[model samples]
Structure formats: C-alpha cells, structure tokens
Target chain A: MESKPISLMILDIVSILLLAVSTYLALVFAPLEAAMGAVQRVFYFHVATAWVGMLGFIAAGITGIVYLATKDLKWDIIEVAAVEISLVFFLITIVLGSIWARPVWNTWWTWDPRLTTAAIIELYYLAYFMLRQGIEEPGRRANFGAVYALLGAPTIPLTFMAIRLFRTIHPVVVGSESAEAQGGFNMTADMRTAFFFALFAFTVIFIDLLWNRIRLGNLQQKLEQLKLNILE
Target chain B: MSAQREKDQKPSAGFLNSVLAVARKDLAAELRSPELLLAMLVFALLAIFIFNFALDLEPALRSRVTSGVLWTTFAFSGTLGLNRSMAVEKENGCLDGLLLAPVDRAAIYFGKAISNLLFLLLLEVVVIPVYSLLYGINLFNPGLLLVVLLGSVGYIAVGTLLSGMAVQARTRDVLLPILQFPIILPMLIASIKASDGFLTGVGLEDAVPWIILLIIYDVIFLAIALMVFDYVVEE
Candidate 1:
C-alpha cells in the first residue's frame, strides 16, 4: 500500500484546523444578523461552499480539456476527482441554500435565475457522472467526460445568462442593493471576518478533499491495471 | 500513417464542399427513408395537441402560451430526431467510414449539425402552419421565423455534438436528453422569449435582446463544438 504523502497529511490537518476556526467564527463570533436572525448565518457557509463548488467545477472542466489534449490518464484521474468533489460540494451548497431560503423566501425554492441555474447545474453534473458511468472503456470514458466538461463551460454560463434574460431575484450579497429589500444582508465587521474566514477555510478543505479524491482515483487506475494483468 | 499519406496525396477538397457533402449525404439517406422526419413531424404535432388539451389553454390564454407550447414540442421532437440521427451512424458503421475519410472532424460536426438544423427547420415549417391553422393564429411573422432560424441553429449546434457522444453510449437513447436539455436550456429560453415577443406584437426591439442572445450562443457553441468535435469522435 502506498503511504499518504506528507504534504497531503499536512493539508488534512490544516484543513480541519481552519474549518474549526471558521465554524467558531461563523456560529459564535459573527454578530447575529439584524433581520433574518439565526437563519442568516447559513449565508457564510452557503457562499463559501458555492465558491468551492465553482472551483472544482472549473477545475474539472479544465482537466477535461487537458486530458483530451495530452491523452494522459493522469489528467483523467484529476478530472474525475474534480467532478466528484464538485458534485458533492454543489449538493451541499444547494441544501444549504434551501435551508437559508425556506425561512427568508417563505418557500423551499424559487425559480429565480441564480436559484434555477444552480439547480440545473446540479442536474447537469449528475448527468455528467452518469455519462462517464455508461462507458466501460477507461479511455473512451475519459474522452467523453472531458468533452462534456468542456461543453459545460459555455452551457453553464449561457444557462445563467439565459435565465437572467428572463429575470433575477437572487440577492446580491456584496453589491450596493439594499439587502433588507432583497432579503439579503450586507456583512458587518465581525460577519465579514467570519465570511472571509469561511471562504479561506473552505478553500483549504476543498483542496484537501480534492487531493484525497485524486489519490483514490490513482489507486483505482492501478487496481484496474492489476486486474487487467491478472486477466492476461 | 498510410491514411495521412493518402489524405495528402489526394486533390484537396474545399472545406465547404466536404461539409456540404456530409450534410448532403445525411439528407439523401433521410430522404430515401423519410421515416425520421415523419416521426419528428408526428411527434411534434402530438406534443402540440397534448399541450393544448393538458394546459386547458382556452382561446384567451392560447396566444400567451403558444410560444411555450411550440418550443416545448420542438425540444421534445428535436430530441427524437437527434437520437435517431446519430444512432443510425453508429449502427451502420457510417461514423467509422466518415472518420476514415480525410475530412476535418469539424466538417463532419458542421455537416451533421447543418443536416440536423435542416430537419428541425423542415419540422418547424410543417408544424407552424399546422399549429397556426389549428389555433387560428397568424403565425407567419418574419420576426418569429428569424427567431426560429437562429434558435434552431444554436440548438442543432449543441445537439449534434452531444448526440454524437450519446449515440456511442450503451444508454444512448436516454442519455441525449439528459446530457442535452440542461445545456440547451439557454437557447430554449431565448428562443421561447423571442418567439413570444414576436407573436405578441411586442415589436422587434423587445425581442432584439433574445435574438442577440441566440446568435451569440450559436457562435460560441459552434466554435466550441468545432474545437472539441475531434475529441468526441476519436478512437
């Protein structure tokens, strides 16, 4: 058995530590929001998770392209890892989003632009995983996955823009829009600290998870090679 | 290596000629059978009827809902045509033959896309008139037709590419829509909005943004599809 690299072990510990600090800051240090009260705390994790999901999504797309260009199984490993991680993080983001929404929007979900786009992307990547599953040949699987991810690059952005062309009610957390009017809240000093900390913590955690997933992918590839060798 | 040598030795065909040749090949084959088109046409008509009844769209509400109904029908029927179109290639060894030819992969993609676009246009031509006659709506507006053209271009651009991938899968039949609908959602939204605008007499100005969106999507996806199509069809 291959040992986990020292850097990865370090990353694992650091990620846990950062996550602990970020949670403390978000749940306790952060001032309670004025309007939405306790429910509003969900925003800190929601945005951070969505950000991590976005990172993994883009990473998968890029690695997909790189896989095609180089025809390297290594890139394929990275691509799948990115995709799997992205899928889980995106699901969390959606659930966290719904938890935040149920109280504020008075419904579990709304068909607003961002909300709609987010949900559609979740489904889209789910299909991506399915597409990869239907093929047994590793090379063909990699090729298709890469192509699909590349396709997502334009499709996802276009989906967002297309929905925006209709209308948007998803609150702009950072912009000048009155948060009270839109059921969003601008951050105070402590909240800002928490928000930024959460973002940093999640970024570290994302990297940790991604590295672990990629290691698993590499091991799976090796196992497949071993099985092939036995068959031969 | 020998194939590359053979490709280089042959007289060069114009890029457009190869693209047209591929599209013509698909057209000729489809015309000979005519079943795919007939099926799409029938399926579209059925969707329109089903929606008309299902939505309980009375005469007063018909105009408002017409564009939605038409696009939904097109989307569903378009799926059928796209699946059949690519699945045929995979079945008859046509895709391999096409790949062996010295044509650029983009030409094949464009050719298939163009033929798919034509099939959709043909379906629209027949469906729109039937829909108009059935509903007593004057559906022959220039703006709406323009939107349809642009929308179909964007849609077929993505569909042909995804369907190419889907047809290779074991679950090819079900995979196309799953892989396609989300990606195609934007084009569908813009097309429906633009069509609705034109049908409602909102003036070209109001529909202009959607039309632009359609064109932009068409251009962007076509470029992306063209670039990645080689990867899709590779051994």
Candidate 2:
C-alpha cells in the first residue's frame, strides 16, 4: 500500500474518535424512555446513520447528474463512492431501527413509511452496484450506472409517499383503533443533544469514508489504465 | 469513427424517421407474429393461477391482496417480455443495426420504450378480463384502468431502458429482473395502492395521487433515460 497523507490519517483518526464519542453519548448519556428503556437509545444512532445515508443518497444522485452532464469519469467515481458508503450505512440504520423497533413497537419490523423508504433506497443502491457489475467497459459501466442512478431519484420520494398514503388510508390494526400512535415518543433535552450529536458525528464519518473510497476508486482506475498501457 | 461521417452525411430529420421506422418495424412484426403478446398473456395468466392457489385468498381477503397479486404477475411477466424483446434485438443484430443508424441516441431509447409499452399494455388488457372472470370480481372501473395504464407506462419506461443495458451483460437473462425489481418497487407500491383503492370502491380522489405519482415517475425517468442513452449506446 502506498503511504497515506497526514491529513487523511488525521481525518480517519478523528472519525473513529467521534464515532466512539457518539456511541458513548447514545448508550449512556441519553435518557431512556419509560416504555422502552435501553433499547430506545438505539434511536440516536439509527437516526444519525439514516441522516448520513440520505446525505450519501442525495450526493450520489447529484454526482450522477454531473457525470451525465459533463461525461466526467471522476464524477462517476464520486458517485460510486457515495452510493457504496450509503448502502453500508443505510444497512446499519435499518438493522438498528429494527433492533429499536423490537422493544418499542413490540415488533421487529414495521412497514412504516420511513423504514419502508430506507429499505427501497437500500435496494436502489444495490441495483446501482449490480448495473455497474454487469458491464465490461468502464466507460459504459459508468454511463449506465449514472443513468440508472438519476432514474431512481424520483421513485424514492414516490415510494415514501406511497407507503405513507397506504398507512394513512389503512392504518395498521392492532386490537384498538386509536392506539396506532404508540410508535412515536417525546424526546427529552439530553436525548435531543445525543441525537443531534450522533447526526453530526455520522456526517463527519460519512465524509471521511467517502473520501477514502474515492481514493480507492482512483487507485483502481490507475491500475486498470496501467495494465492497458503495458499491454499496448 | 466512419459511422459518424455516415451519420453526418444524412439529414438529422431523416435519421429520426429511420428510428421511428425501426419502431414501426418492431410493432408491425409483433402484430404479425403475435407470439410475444401471446406468450406474455399466457405467462400472466399462469402467474395469476399460481397466485390463486398460492395465497388461497377468499373474497374479502382478495380485495386487499388483488393489488399485490396483479402487480407481482405484471412485474414478472413484464421482465420476461423485456428480456425476450431486448435479447431478440441483440441476437439478430437489430440493436447493432440501430446503433449504426444515423439517428439521435434517444431515438433508439424511445423506439424500444414504445414497443415495450405496447406489449405490456396488450398483456394487461387481456389479463384484466381473465382476472375478473376467474375471481368473480368486477375490474371494469375506469379509475382502475387509468392506474394500470400509468403503472405499466412507468414500469415499462424504465424496464425498456434498463433491459437494453442488461441484455449486453454476461448475465443477460438473469440480470434484468434483479435490476428491474428494486428500481420499479415504488411503481409497484404506488400501483398496488391505487389499484386496491379502485378495487375496493375507493373514489378517484383516493387514487388520483398515486396515478399522479406514477406519471411524475414516468416523466422523470423518461427524461433521464433519454439524456444518458447516448452513453449506453456509445461505441
């Protein structure tokens, strides 16, 4: 491996330290809900990961657009970096949400709008990778991947709205009619602080990971180009 | 490199005409053979039959589950038809012929999209009546038809574009569905919601938003597909 830059090393260290601090705050500093206890603490990291996931998602779409507009291979690398990190973070977010849901909602899964949207977004990212995997030429792979990424943008919001509307029309029935509001709980000031801090921490982590991934993509591109040059 | 010079020699308008001509040829061929349509229709029917036994849905349960079943069958059959259509083009060198045409790249995209939409709509129309007969459910609601149309349009619009790319891959046969299902999930969900709304006697007001969502999806994706089709088709 090539020697890493000092700034990148520092950013990586800072990311790990912040992630540790965020976990500490979420697990111990935040107050627990009366109904759910310790499991409710999962909400902080869950929301934070989701926040970063959305950031990556939107960034991928924007980079996709840029790639299409300028036909820039660099933007394609950036897009893939954002999407891969988003996929991993979103998976964690979904798992964490499920863990939290087990205690709070008394079920490990809910077809709730936000959760459903996250799941769809996860699938979208998966499809993005699959599209890239199928092509032999790097340029074609980047172009097709960029196209599909842009195509998926509107559908994500529509998916959220569809589930939301479906829920509103046919609320999840569990014995009583009005008891459907139990999933949401009020957050205390300390919980809010932890929650916001987790978001901030995850954002930093997302950026750091994205930059590393982009560098890795560049390295891979360089190796491919070198191999082509040696062959010719 | 020579292809560009050949393209430049022709008037752009003539190039567009040739693209439409290619679309027309596909449509006319499908009209004649009817094999594609017949296959899709029968596959859809088989899917519904399997679902009938699979779910064991009663009259009351069927009302809610019908949307899911219908969309599921449509999705699978849609992918099947998309694969066959694109694979045929690729196999016969029709796609390469189109690529060699002096037309805008988007012309190829639209041509495929139009023909794909035709096959999907044809199957949907046939399947609806069969579904009504099989289940004793009246599916003649105009609102329901509108939702079906919008959903198929959105589904096929993306399906056609993606399948073009998928057909070029090593895993051409299997890759289309794997790529299609996730991207089209929103359309499936939205269509299911709207179709269920119509089936259960829900008014237009209830289904309108889903239909609108489908329209917006179709338009946005169509634009994106047009913009990037050049890249996918580039040599």
Candidate 3:
C-alpha cells in the first residue's frame, strides 16, 4: 500500500469532526419532530447513512463499468470498497429505520419501496461478494465480479419502480377515514435543514470511509503479491 | 488465410449446430436420467405441501394463498434445477468444452436458458395440477399460465447466466441461489401481482402494466447477460 498522504489523513479527521457536529446538530440544534418524539432523532443519521449507502451503490456500478472497459484491477478494488462501505451504511439505515418504525408505525418492517429496494440491493452486493469469493483465478474473479456488478445494476431500479407502481395502483387503507393517512408526513423548514445537512455530512463521511477501505484493499493485494514472491 | 476468412464471414451452421448440439445433448442426458426434472418436481410439490401445512387454512381460504404458493414453488424449485444443471456441466468439464466450441457465447447462454426454462415449465405444469388437487382451487386461468411463462422466462434468463458464473466460484453449489434470489425479486413481485390478479378474477387491464414491466425486465437483463457472458467466460 502506498504511504498515507497528509491531505487524506486531514480529510479523515475532518470527516470525523463533521460527523460529530452533524450528530450534535441533529440531537440538539434540530427540534424534535412533534408527532414522533425522541425516536425522530434517529432520522438524521438514518437518512445520512442511507444517502451514503446509495452513493456507494452508484459508485460501485460506475466503477464496474470502468473496470470492464479498462480491464484494470484497481477499479475492481474501488468497486469492492464502494460496495463494502455502502453495505455497512445501508445496514445502519435499515436498523435505524426499524427502531424508528417501532414507535411510529408499530411495525419493525414495512413493504415501502425504498426500504424493500434497500434490502434487496444489500442482498445483491452480498451476492456480489459471494460470487467473488468463489472464483480462484484473480483475473477471472475480477472479470466475473465486474460483469455481475453491471448485471445487477438494472434490477435495482426496476425493483424500485415495480414496488412503487404496485403501491400506487392499490392504495393501502390502513385504519383511515381520511385518504391522506398512509405514512405520509409533512416536513417543517427546520427539519428540512437538519435533513439536508445530514445528507451533506454523510457524503463527506462516505468519501473518507471509501478512501480508507480502498487503501486497505491495496495493502491486502500488495501483501498477497509479496507472499507469492517470497515463496518463489 | 483461415483467420482472414473467419474475420470476413460468419461460420454458417457450424456455430448454430454446436449450440443446438449442446442443447440437445443436455436434453437427452436429462431425459435418460430424469434426475434434474424429477428433483425439481419433487421439490415444488414439497414446497406446496409445506406452504399448505404451514398455513393450515381452510379450502375457502386457499384461493388467496394460491398465487403466492405457486410462485414460491417455482422460484425455489427453479433454483434447484439451475444449480444442478450448471453444476453437472462444470463437474463433467462440459462447460469448458462448450466454451472451446466455435459458437458465440450468447448462443450458449440462450441454449442453457432455454433448457432451464423447459425444466422449470415442466415442473410448474405438474405442480399446478397437484396444487389445485391438494388445495381444491382452480388453477387453469389462461392469464395465470401466461404469467407463469413470462415470469419463468425472466427468471431463467438471469438465473442461467448467474449460475454459469456461480458454478465457477469456490462456493459453487450454495452460491447460485444466494446470487439468484435477490436479483430475481422484481420478476417475482411482478409475476405474483399479475398471477394474483388473474387467479382472483381481475381484468387483463389490471395486469397489463405488470406484464409490461416483466417484458421490459426480461429484455434489458437478457441484453446485459448476453453482453456480460463473454466477460464471465473469458480466459
């Protein structure tokens, strides 16, 4: 692995600081959502992490395209990094959403399009890793991984659209006389500020994590090559 | 001279012949042993039984559960046939032989996909009769059968491609289903909705959109898998 540049190291620290400030802003500066109490506080981190999760998925897809075109191992490494970070962030988002949902909706899970799509996307990448782990040849692994990643990308959006279309056509009548009742909430200006800033903060955090993860990937590859050379 | 000729003109029936030969070979092999088709059939029946016992509802209540049960059976048993079909080819070293043939990779993909779809459809055809008998619900709706065909086509399209890649991995046996189920969710959902609509006496107007979505998904992924198969099989 290459030596850590001073700028990346500084960026790492800045991300941590920003995350802390963002949490504080979410916890303190932002007012609690009136209808939902303390649980609403989880929304800031939830959306932030989900934002990064999405960013990671899109990044991995783009890197998959680039890797296929260039036939480069470096892009494969970047793809893995983006996928791993996104997987963890999406897990956090799901958990936080579940926790928040418990109090608000009285259910741990819902068939909402985005949540279901997130779960499916998470599974898609899990399959991605499993696919990578099975191949013994590095070149074949890189090629197969790139191909699978590219193939999996289209299904994610289609899955999202299918669910949305299904829901829209058949509205769920959940104990409501008024038609305006199925899980829709209006956001105040203050809530919007906190929400958007959390997204911004998480974007920074995602870049930092992606950088570290890619560096770790590089280190692992170098060590493997070194081991091969020493054996020879 | 051969390289120049090859570049200038396609390989006529040689390529298509190899593809058809491979497909015919697989079909004949399965016909003799019948292990792949039988296993998928038994698995689909077992799944329907499990769903029946698991739900433990009256016959009157079974209509609502029929679509879900039918699709689940198809999905699970389809995965079985897919994994076994590819695993057999890999174990016998035939996959490598197929790759060595003078055929376009897309031809191999289509050939495998068609055979896999055949296996799935065979199982589904039998499962419907067994399910209707067991649950005492009618399963002969034309629209429902249409959904079955379209859904299985989409499922097998992606499944055959992924199973090809999965069979090459170290975790070959267990990896196919893990890789397939998540990616196939859209097809599953669309199929279920369309099938449910038909089974419950809903209009074709209600089901056309989901069918359109299925057609779009099948076309897009078929193109993607076709394009990517070369990469997957490349040395």
Candidate 4:
C-alpha cells in the first residue's frame, strides 16, 4: 500500500482541530439549556455522530449496490469501510443519546423508536461482519455481503417509520412545528453554530477514517494474494 | 417456427411446474423422514414450556404475554427449521442438482420459502392449540391467525434467502438467526402488536396499521429474496 497522502494528513489535522473547537463550542460557547441543563449539551455531539452514521449507512448501501452491479472488489472494500465507520459513529450516537436521556427522561433507556431502531441497526451491521467471517471465499463473501447490505438498506427507513408510528418520546430536533412544545428546546444562535460545526467536523473525520480503512483493506488484499503466490 | 414456439412456452410453464416440483420434493422428503417438522415442533413446544416457567405465567397475565411468547417461540423454531432445511440440501448435494436443472433459480428460492413457510404454519397449528389448552385462552382468533400467516410469510421470505447463504458458510447453522433476526425485527414487532390487538379484542382501527406493515414487509422481502437469490446461490 502507498504511504498516506499529504492531503489526508492535512485532513487529519483539520478534523482534529475542528473536533476540539466543536467540543469547546458545545461545552463553553453554547448557553446552558434551561430544562435539561448541562446534559442537553450532549445533543450537539449526539446529533453530529448520528448524522455521520447516517452518511456511512447510505454510502455502504450505495457502494454495496455498485459492487453487486460491477462485480468490483474495490467497491466491496468501500462498502465495508463505510459500514465500519457507521458502526463506530452510531455507537457513539447511541451512547451519547442514552447519556442525554438519563438526565432528561429520568431513565437510562427508553423504548423510543429512534433509540430502538438505532440499536437494531447496530445489531444489523454487526451481523454483517459475522456473515462475512463465516465465508472463506472472497468473491462469495463479498456477494453475500452486498446482498445483505442491499436487503438491510430499506430497513433503516422502514424501521424509523415503524418506530415513529408505534410511538416516540425522543425529541424531534428539527422540522417539527411542536418541537418546543414537546419538551424539546430550540437551539440558540451559539448552540446552532456549535451543532452545525460538530456536524461538519464529524463529516470530515468520517471521510478521513474511511479513506484510511480502505487503504487497510487494499493492503490486506495484497497480503492475501502474496500468501497465495508464495504457497503456489 | 414450431420448435421455437414450443421452447418459448416451455420455460414459462416449466417455471411454475419447477417451483411446485421443488416444493413437492421437499414435502415428500420431509414426509418420509419427518425430521425437520418434528424437530421444529418439539423445539417450539420446548420454547413455550420454557417461556411458561421463565415468565411464571399466571392466568391473568397469560393473555397479555401470549402474543409475545408465541412470536418468540415461532421466531426461534423458525430459524432451526430454516437452517436444517438448507443444510439438508447442502448435505445431500441436492442444491447442486437443483442448480443444474433447466429452471429459473428463483423457482428454487420460492420452492424453499414455501416449504419453510409450510413447516412454520404447521408448527403454529399444533402449538396454538397446545398453548390454548395449556393457558385456557381461546387461541382461535381469525385476526391473530392472519397475523401469523403474514408474519410467517415475511419471516420465511427473508429466512430462506439468508439460510441459503448461511448454509453455504463455515458457520452455517449459527449464522442464520444472527443474519435474520435484526432484519426481521419490524415484522416481528408488527406481528406481535397485531396479535395483541386481536387477542385483547381491540378495534380493527388499532390493528390495521400493524397488519398493513406486515403485508408490506412480506411483499418487499419476498420480492427482494427472489431478486437476490440468484446471487446467493451462485457458485
């Protein structure tokens, strides 16, 4: 595998810098939330991580479809990279959400649809790895992974709808007219800046991590080929 | 021209016949041995018994918990049936034989799915009455039965596809449920909700959305399984 490009090094530095700034903004710049107090501050990182998670989820599905269509191993690697990054980001999202929920909802967990769906999505991706591990042949493994990824793609939206329809106590942060009325507070200007900056920071970090993981996958593939050649 | 006409008609007619043929083959094999059905039935009954002890089902609480218990048992036993059904094909080399046949690959998928669905429904038929006998609650609600049917369709549709892949893996049996459960959760949730509504004598308005969701899950998964089965079964 080639050395890390200069651009990626710059991205890594920028991402780290932005993450520090984003955290500072959330912790210090944003006004303390009236109802939930300091715990509500977790919302900035929570939503930003969830946003990055969603981005990875969509990328995985799209790359999965492309792999299936083109029969390209590169796309398979990209799909795996996307799913891995999404999995990590989503874990953060869920944990942060739970932390926020503890102070606000007076419980560590609630069966809110978003929470339930997020948990299920986490399990779904974990199962993706399990399925891949059980297959020895690379092509077949990639094929099954792509098919499973495609099958799981629809579940994300459907799961959200199912949970939303069932019932939801989780705050709808944006685009709901009754947000403020539903125990959800509107973001102040400073909070909005922190929130959007967090989102931007996480997107940059997700890309940097994904690029690094793809390189790792390429190296792993090369090593496997080398072993096969040596054995022959 | 006559030969071309016959060839054109053959595949279409052959498709349905091939599907039924595969289904019949599995049915006949199961009838001869009865291993798959017997195991699923026994396992399902054991699950219910375990649930009875685990939940400490008092008479008053049984009605409320019955839907959840029944679906859980079905889902667990369904995975067993799915794993075994596909494993049998792999063990006997029947999968390769089926692949070599002059039929659409999707027919094999439909055939396997139908057989798996039949096994689940049969288990439900016996288990429901047994559950009713044990709990003394009437389990013969049509609405609940419809939920069971739709839920099984949705479950088996995806289960068949996943098991087909799972049975090919090194960790064949252990992998199906892990691959299946998360994806099938929505259907399970909807089924349970619909079943509860029916059991509690809730109005149709409350249950209709769940029923609709079940149907949507069934149709969407069945279509996807058919489309993707070719890739799954490709050597």
Best by DockQ: 1
Instruction: State how far residue A151 of model 2 sits from its true place (Å).
Output: 1.7
The candidates, ranked best first by DockQ, are 1, 3, 4, 2
Worst 10 residues of 4 chain A by lDDT: A174-183
Residue A67 displacement in candidate 2 (angstroms): 1.4
lDDT of 3 by residue, A1-232 (tens): 4689898899999998988888888888888767777787887898789889989988988999999889889999999999899999999999998998787778898887877898998888888888888887888988888887887788899999889874432113223333533444455777777778888988988998888998898898899899999999
Clashing pairs in 4: none
Q: Estimate each model's TM-score.
A: 0.96, 0.91, 0.92, 0.96
lDDT (Cα atoms) of all candidates against the true structure = 0.89, 0.83, 0.83, 0.90
For candidate 1, chain B by itself scores a TM value of 0.95
Best by lDDT: 4
Q: Give the TM-score of candidate 2.
A: 0.91
Q: What ranges in model 2 sit over 4 Å off?
A: A168-180, B1-16
Ranking by lDDT: 4, 1, 3, 2
- The best-first sequence of candidates by TM-score reads 1, 4, 3, 2
Residues B5-51 of candidate 2 have per-residue lDDT tens digits of: 65677787876686678679888988889878788888899999899
Q: Where does model 1 exceed 4 Å of error?
A: A178-181, B1-13
Worst 10 residues of 2 chain B by lDDT: B1-10
Interface RMSD of each: 0.9, 1.6, 0.9, 0.8
lDDT of 4 at B39: 97
Judging by lDDT, tell me the better candidate of 2 and 3: 3
Clash-forming residue pairs, model 3:
A134-B169, A134-B170
Model 1, A216: alpha-carbon shift in Å?
Answer: 0.3
Complex DockQ per candidate: 0.86, 0.62, 0.79, 0.77
- Badly placed stretches (over 4 Å) of model 4 are A177-183, B1-10
